[model samples]
Target: MCNALAFVEEPTDKHAKSDGYCGRILRAQTQGTRRDGYNEFRLRVEGDPENYQPASIYRVTLYASSPSYFRGFTLIALKEGTEGTRDDHYAGKFQIIDEEDTQFMTNCPPAVTESTPRRRTRIQVFWTAPPSGSGCVILKSVPFKKILILLQQLLHYYHYH
Candidate 1:
């Protein structure tokens, strides 16, 4: 069994905008499978409801106490015939466990559609956890530009932008 599994932040209006936007981990659960365990997580990013940019991209990072326990990661299943491809929205693997953190970007559209202008976008991810371990995980989200700089420093890679 996992030792500590909790949402990094509760979904609320107050926490909806820490800065220009607010990133919250809405849910995280572990499901037992025949071969391995699946750690499912849901993250939401909220911007100004009245002035939110649907095309805006956000960078999300997942930190684990035992990084090696996470063998693989995949975004949750999406609706068929969706307009966007995972490659179109997903930035792919940024930093792996070797760097003590895992990072990715949400370049896709919001999973949930609102009748009116809504401030929030959400995505689901599945992390393959080792069969036996007691590790904790935490997540954070920030603007893509900031994360790009940080990734360059952490990864020692240069980006034209």
Candidate 2:
């Protein structure tokens, strides 16, 4: 389920270099003012193949498993319809596991208005660079397609418990 993944270096913000698309590893070493290799990536759900749009939702999780200093990370889900767009939709934040690592789980970061003629869907995860210049960032893979399934399971578990 962790196949569909895209690694981008600060696509939205101007702090880091913009590494358009380069699979998992955006850069092997940091450089210039971009001393931080931090970045944000989107897990999109364009909908079914046959039908143009199908009812859908997303579940996003951010996990940091590194041995260095990390400021924090934010996850946001934005939606754009035939009419216009949305704002800084804060999904959730990663928990500071220690002085250097953290993890986060969004029960169901706001849903996209499927009936609002929404053409595409995306889960954006943003990360900050480690202060120690350790050049170490570890993140678990998030499957783009199974977002609905994972969200359902999370919701059901939350309600059931």
Candidate 3:
């Protein structure tokens, strides 16, 4: 097991979002905590306006909690400029815990990986383009615990019925 310490950080850079058909940029953010337990946080991303060519970028962050401290990390995602091909990047990048300037933990579960580069965790940003949409960012924290919760919910629903 690793020594638990928490801290706060932001994504590598900011991003702009165009029509989802075109691609949206991805960003990362990090924050820290003292207690090691199940937690949930939110990330906000905005799209460009209808008159501005439908393009904008936003940042995303990640956080970790320990018995005594908190840690964080971040990254950037760029829109590829295609129609209906903009994919999520955070859902693949690994969570970085930089202590002594070295990334600590590696890949883990509950986080989805795609045919793209393999990553530890992905900042799941749920949003829709302009003209008609409300954005929602699902920042998945504890993968294992989340999976358990999902399973439990499913089981509860399955047996309770």
Off by over 4 Å in 2: 1-126, 133-135
Give the alpha carbon lDDT tens digit for every residue of 62-122 in model 2.
3222222122222322111110122232211222323222224332322211111112223
Candidate 3: worst 10 consecutive residues by lDDT?
A: 21-30
Ranking of models by TM-score: 3, 2, 1
What is the C-alpha local distance difference test score of candidate 1? 0.25
TM-score for candidate 1, please give it. 0.22
Using lDDT, give the best candidate's number: 3
Q: Residue 12's C-alpha lDDT in candidate 2? A: 19
Instruction: Give one digit per residue, the lDDT tens place, for model 1 in 1-161.
Output: 33222222221111111111111211111211111442232333232122212233333333222211222232221212221233332221222222122223242222211122212233223232212232332332221212333334423422321
Candidate 1 displacement at residue 5 in angstroms: 1.7
- The estimated TM-scores of all candidates read 0.22, 0.24, 0.24
> lDDT scores for all predictions?
0.25, 0.26, 0.27
**Counted clashes in each candidate structure:** 0, 0, 29
